[model samples]
Structures are given as structure tokens and as C-alpha cells.
Target chain A: MANKHYAMVIDLNTCVGCNACMAACAMENQTPVWKNSWRTYVHDLEIDPGTDHQVRRRFFPRLCNHCDNPPCMSVCPTGATHKLDNGIVLVDDELCMGCRACSMACPYDARFDVSYNDVEQGKEFYGELHHRTRPGVDKCSFCAHRVMKGLKPACVETCVGSARLFGDLNDPDDKVAKLVKTGVAKPLMAHLGTRPNVYYISEIERAR
Target chain B: MEGMFYSTQNVWTWWIAIYLFLGGLGAAAVVVSCLTNMYIKTHKELVLWGNISAFVMLSVGSLFLFVHLLDHLAVIHVLNPFGLLTKPDAWIMWGTQFIVWMMVFSMIYTLPYMLETPFWRDMPLVGTILGWFGWLGKLSLSFHKVVGWLAIINGVGTVLYTGLLLQSFPAVALWHNPGVPLLFIISAFSTAMAFLLLVLHLAIKREEDHDIKVLYERTDVILISIELLIIFVFFHFTTYGLESARHTADILWNDMGWIVGFIGFGLIVPFLIEFRGVTKGWNSATPVVLAAILVLCGGYLLRHYFMYAGSYERPYPAINSIHSQSNYNLLIE
Candidate 1:
């Protein structure tokens, strides 16, 4: 099979910051309920100068960018964090020594701590995945399991505003590839040279 | 661009700082011990102390790192040699392998001398087991210069690795500077000398060897001065380079607790006292002990402050999530 380059595009203009996607991701991935789960997050871009809740606010959804040149993968001492043939970054929890070096290397701060042994709760939610059974570094897998089954990520499927889109960028006819070719979708911190797969499309001017 | 999004709290804590400090101390001890043994004929006592110190400090340092892991039992994963050969960019893998080799070499270098001691002589079984490899130590002595040189090279790698560990973290501006390795290497040697001085005075009661004592004291004074100068450059470069680095610089500059306690009292005072003591030909234990203690504490605190100074660039700072630190007042405008 040809290699796939999966990517996600979050439409900032449509996102309500309701965190419905976050909930869906947690349920689907069996991520930690603790405050620092890494599956996905919503950042409210406070661009407005007024007190009005209805105006000038942009909800920016963030997850592991799963970069083409992931620094996190580069720094992993044990090769626990790796990029699959499909372009999704993954952690081999069994191989992870809980060094936290990869977590420090991530520019987006997308990685989370799951090195504790008491994390049976996430395992109970996820059942048995050979790599993710034990505690180690945690981050978004781009929902590789679902994507492999010809389905969208839980977050993309459940987005109320249809704000999230996921598809194989390798397919030139894919919606994500066409949207990216349009030049409106911007990857966060593009200058960092990670070549993040996650992109955002925004109508509002970014704050200086 | 600054103060947009307060940084999410990082997971590394004081344990990591202490581990870095100890790793440096142990590396310096090993290097200095090997150098002294090779070059100076009359410093057998100093070499012995350095060897023992290197072994103890490095072992304890590795223990701290092992304990820092989220799952303490899974440490064997780090021992896999596949990571080292396959991943050249993995400094942690390099570090683990280096330290393991360092420990082995340190034990090899120290065993012959240890056998000569009354404790080892009393246990003849140790001699019986060690007799098989006794030729290695004898061979080591024949090529003592070469062995010592190898130790020095590995020691330097270990020290630089501690700094490189932090430098690889490109996100945290405070930890990503090239100056980190240089500063850490200098501090490691200084603290290692201080550690030796304390042991010489307290454990061996070696007040007779004024020449060696004065040499260490003079060297530490100079190291402390170099440390201050490097710190100045570290701050100057960061403050002018990028906004995130400037944010880290601001945090460092405003931190009166670190400045007054660590740099001022712990570092500068020790330098002044040791310098004054060395120049005046004053040979009191009080001044030496005080300076040594200060240098050791100051080195540890420098690592502590570096961890606290880590800050991330908040490009989209408006999202006030529960993960955000509460102390940063949100921009009202």
C-alpha cells in the first residue's frame, strides 16, 4: 500500500470552543480525565478588546501536530515515540522509560505525562492495545485506529460546527489537500521547522 | 507577543535539578582524579579521594534519575542498547551508556588501591575474585596515561551531556542556550574541587599538604569568576535574541531570591573568601570549609533556578484553560 500523510485542519471561524470535540476524543481514546490529557485542547484566542462574549473571540483547537520532522520523536531516548508510515506520531508506552525528554522537546507542548503506574483507568477505557497498555508519554495518535478503518477521528465526527476535518494529504483529491492547497490553512509556528501536519483556517486577523 | 498565554506548568521539578548537579559533580571528580594521577606524582591521596567521590556521587546521581521515572520498575527499558546504536540524536541514550561505562572504569581504576587498604585486605575472598582481573589493573597502570586520558574524555562528554540535555529542549528558551554546556562544565569542575577540599579537610584532616590545598583553593576562586562572566553572557545573549528568550531573561533578572541567595551569598561570597584566603597565605580550616560548602550549594541552586525560569511562547495566549497557571493575570484589553 502507498504511504499516507494524514492531516487535520481546524476551522477557527466555525469553532465555538464548546469542547465537544475534546469530550468525544476523551471518550474515544480513553484519555486521562486529569487536567493535562493530550488528545486535544481548545485555546480561546482572545483578540477582542471588549467585554462582550459574543464578539471577536476565536477558539483554536490544538493537538499533537504529528510533524513531518517531529522533534519529540528525534529526542526520544528509547525510540518510544515514532512516526508511522501513515504520518501519525505514536508512543510505545512499553518502551517509554518515563524520561520526559520527548515532552520537553515538543514545541507545541502537546505531550502529556502518563508515566504513573496507577493509570489503569485509561487502560480500562481503551482495553488492550499492545503499545499503550502501560504508563508512558501520552499524545494524540491522530486517531490512527479509526482512520485505518476508513472512518474519521472521533473529534472530527462529533464537531458540532463541522470545524474539524481529517483526511490523507497524500491523496491529491482529498478535501484536506484541496483546502491546504488553497493557501488559507496555516500551520502554527511554521518557522519552527517541524512542518506540523495540523493546520488552522481563520477568518479573524491574528493578534500581534 | 509576551504574556499572551501563561505557560502550562511543566512536569520537571527539583529532583531533576539535583540529578543534573550531581551528574556534573561526579563527572568532574572522575576527570580531575585521572588528571591528577597522570600529571602529579605526590597527589596519590587526592586521586584516591576523587576516585571514591566519583563512584559514590555517580551512583547516587543515577539512583535519583531512576527514582524520577514515573514507573520506577521500568528502568530496564533504558538499558536496551538498540536505542544507542540506532538513534544518534538521543542524548539520553548516550548519557546512560556513558555513565554505565564511567562507573565500570571508575571501579577498575579504584580497585587496586582499595585492595591495598586495611578493609579490603581483611576480606581475602575479595582478593581471590579480583586476582583473575588483577592483570587489568596492572595493565591499566602500565598504560596509566592512556587510561587517564580516556577517563578525561568520557568525563568531559558526561558533563557536556548534562547541559546538552537541557539545550535540546528548544521550546524552553532558558534551557536551550549553548551557554548551558559551557556554564555547566565550568561549574562542575569548581564544585568538584570544592567537594575534594571539604573531604580533604574533614575526612583526611590533611592540613599538612598546604601546596595541594592552595592549588585547589586558587583554582576554585578562578572558576567562580569565570562562572559569573559566563552567566553575564548567557543573560545578554538570551535577552537580545528572541521574545521568548527575553521573557525567560526577564524572569531570571527579576528573581531576587535566586540572585541574592544563590549567586550573591553562595557563589560570590565563596569566591571572595577563597581568593582572600589564598592571597594572604592564611591556612585556616574555617575559610576553606565555608567556601567549599557555599560552592556546592550554589551549584545546586543554579540548576534549581534554571528549571524555574523555563517559559513557553504563547502565540495564541487568549485561551484560559484550567491547565494555565493562575498567577498570570489575563490581559484585560
Candidate 2:
């Protein structure tokens, strides 16, 4: 009833496995400098067990699934974590009890602990005296803050190929909706029932 | 290998191990104080309910964590939970706070009831307020969620959070398997049972009627049976998956599964001792001691595995190795 469903369409056909999307996400969100992946590429299969995995690997970058029934949301003791009407789960960093329950509840390892920069730490101070902190969990928000400002996500705009599409699936007339109407997309880790917003359109299975 | 793919219980294992041990300790402390309340029980022969419970709960719970944490703190760089989120042990910040609060509160609550007498009627009131706050500590048990929705958030949150910690981890494939949370819920029930037995033993001036004692012990028996089953199934999954799955757990244990600890002196042995006490009807100080020891040890073992197996793990090889294995390229190439 709350216009909460979100949809993402990723065209595997055009994706050249470039990591522009991940970089864009990191920079746009001002993610912690030392944090690993804010978003990542998952694959339909594990890499072929070989020494040349990176070169042969078909990139399946992934972000949060924004499930309709997030286990993390239900288990929040302080109500610090919640799913928005748009189906994304966001944490109130200010209110978080600093408990790791939601991080634990996430089936996809979607929650990560990162100490957000107190102020926008410019690139000059990229790596420096790091401090241990009572960390909170972070995940992709579909770049919601940017979307409301009437701009495409940095990742979507920077894509060399128009491979990533973000829009309201609820608007049947929207482009993402049209693509979803025809594109056979799959959510990574669908078996876990997180129902991620990012979807992949693939036609063939490659070597693992 | 054992808990691979799943993540919730990895955290839950830690929460349960810590909380379960702490929870037992809290209950045990109450029992010990109850025994000390000589004013309430006039007929020593009537039956010692409260004091017995307190000692059992305290001794057993303390036994479980005391030795293990001594070992862990010696090596870990534990950061205070109040700090920002940069620390690896940040998740533990809230958990440790909860454990500390609960232990203190349990002591406070037990003291008033254990020492309740005509001379000091108001002493229990001080404990009551603290008890309320301590109960509030239960909400903090989940650590990830903040304190928002309502006053009751922490207690209910602890239950679910504790459940997830054990079942959510990745390498504890079996612990995070389908039945672990169910087991933890049962563990809470068992902890409650252990708590009650300590109550029975600590009766001060009067002895509990034989019938009420029977009820509590029977409940413990049934719950233990259910708990043992849960543990059995959990082990079944871990051992089987460990044998077949990928990852370090396949080796019977990696450095991380040290949560299992040294063979005879390890956590499982403590559990076995309790199990033996349960079967032999060693319900007095012995069962309480055994249960407290085992459950607490079990809880620590749970956390130890998660720390050892998942999260804050060493980085992937500096060189990307995803494609070298046949498993990587087809998925990637």
C-alpha cells in the first residue's frame, strides 16, 4: 500500500565488468576511506578454480536487496533500523545502540561496520590515523539522497555502457518498468529471500 | 565451511555465548543471595529454594565465562562500545555493556529478595529500580538496534538478537543452519530453568514445598532434553558440513574454531558435566554447578567461534585470487 517497491535493472549485455559503479558509489556516498566494498560484484557462479580468476571472472556487482521483509528491520532493539516506504532499509546512525544485531541478521552479509567520516575527509587525508569506534552498519540506499536531488546515481551516470537502470517499477510507464516487462532479470542470492532491487539480465551461464 | 554462507548466527553465537553465560550468572547470584537470606526460611528443613538457586546460577555461569574471557581479553583489543564505529570490536560494545549491566542488576535484585526482612523493608526497593534498568539491559543485548520503539525494546530485542547471533554466522554453517535459533530460544528457556533451580536452593528461612521443587526440576529435565536435541542437530550439521564444505572449518577446526577449545578441558566437556548431572539427578549444588558451567561455556564457545571464523577476518589475499580456481573464472570470465 505504501508505494514501497523499488526496482533496478542491470544489463549484463552492455556491462564490460568495469568497476565504475562501485567507485562511483564509494565517492558519491563519501564512504569510510578504509572500508572495503560498499557495493560489490557477485557472480552467478564462483570463479573457475584457477590462478587467473580475476581476468576470467564475469563481474556481478551487487548492493543491498532492500527486501520487503528484512530480518534486520524486525530485530532492531532500538528501532534504529527501519525499511522505508520505498522498500530500502536505512540505519539511523545517530540513534543506533551500536549493537550488531542487524548486521548479524542480514543473510547476505549486506550490513558492514564503518565509522563514517565526522566531516567530509577530503581525498588529501585519505589514509591516516584511524581510530577504533563503536561502529554502525551501512549498506546501499539506492543513493536515495542523490535521487531526491533530481540526479542519476553516480554509478549509473558514469557507466561506459548504459547497463544500469534505476527507476520506480511501480510506474508502469517508466523505462525501468518497460525493461522489467521484457528483461529476464535475476536478483543475486534470491534463494535467501532478500529480493534485492538490483537485478541482472543474463542469457548464458559461464565457467565457474 | 561449517557456517559458511550464513551470517546472522555468527553474531548471534557471540551474543548467546556472552548473554547466556551472563544470564546464568545473574540468576546464580540471585540464588546465592537467596541462600543467604536466613530470615525468610525459618524451617531449614522446609527446603532451601532461593539460596541454592543463587549459588548454582552464579557458580555455573561464572565458571563458563571466567576461564574463557581471561584467555580472550589477554589477546583482544576490546574497544569501548560508546566509541564511534571504526573499531572491529564495536559490535561487542553494546553486548559487553549489557552483560555487565545484567550481572550487576541480577546481583542487586537477588540481594533484596535474599535479604528481605522486617528490619530492612526498603532495601528491596533500591533493587527494584535497578532491576528495571537491568531488565532494560536486555534490550541492549542485541547491540545493533538502538533503543527507540518503546521501553520494552531491549528485552524483546535481546531475545531476537540473541537468536540471530548464533544462527546468522557464515562458517558455523551448522550453528546457523535451520535449527540454531530454535535452539537458542530453547537455551533462553533453559537459562530460565537454571535460574529457577537456583531460586529453589536459596530459600532462606523456609523450605519450598516438595511439590514446587518437583515442578521446577521436571521443567529443567524436559527443557534440557529439548536443548540437548538442539545441540545434537546443531553438531550434526557442523560436523557433516565441515567434512564436505569449503573453507577452514573443513579441517575439523581452523584457528578460529578454537571456540571449541582444548579437548577435555574445553566448553563441551563442561556441558557434558551438566548433562551428566541432569541424568543422575544431581539436582543440588552439583547440577546447578554443572549446568552453570556447561551453559556458560557453551555460550563462550559460541562467541569464540564467531570471532574465530567470521567478520573482521584477514583481508583476501593482496593479489586478487578469485579467478585462479576453476570456480572463479566461469563465474567471472
Task: Identify the leading candidate in terms of lDDT.
Answer: 1
Candidate 2 CAPRI-style tier: incorrect
Candidate 2 error regions (>4 Å): A1-4, A37-46, A49-55, A116-135, A203-208, B1-16, B24-161, B164-178, B185-225, B236-296, B306-333
lDDT of 2 by residue, B1-333 (tens): 211221112233443455454443343333322332333333222212433343344445434433433122321222243332443222233333444344444333333323333333345684455455554444433431222122122223333334555454432344356575565555554555455554455532124444444454555556556766665564456555443222424333444345345223233454455555546656456555555445545544644453434321111211111112232222122
Q: Which DockQ-derived CAPRI band holds candidate 1?
A: acceptable
Model 1 bad stretches (over 4 Å) = A34-36, A44-46, A50-55, A115-118, A123-132, A205-208, B123-139, B316-333
Interface RMSD of each: 3.6, 10.9
lDDT of each: 0.77, 0.48
Candidate 1 lDDT tens digits, A65-125? 9999998988888888888988999987777877788877787768777745437665665
How does model 1 score on DockQ? 0.47
lDDT, candidate 1, equals 0.77
| TM-score between model 1 and native | 0.89
* DockQ for all models: 0.47, 0.08
Clashes of 1: 3
Residue A191 of model 2: what lDDT?
52
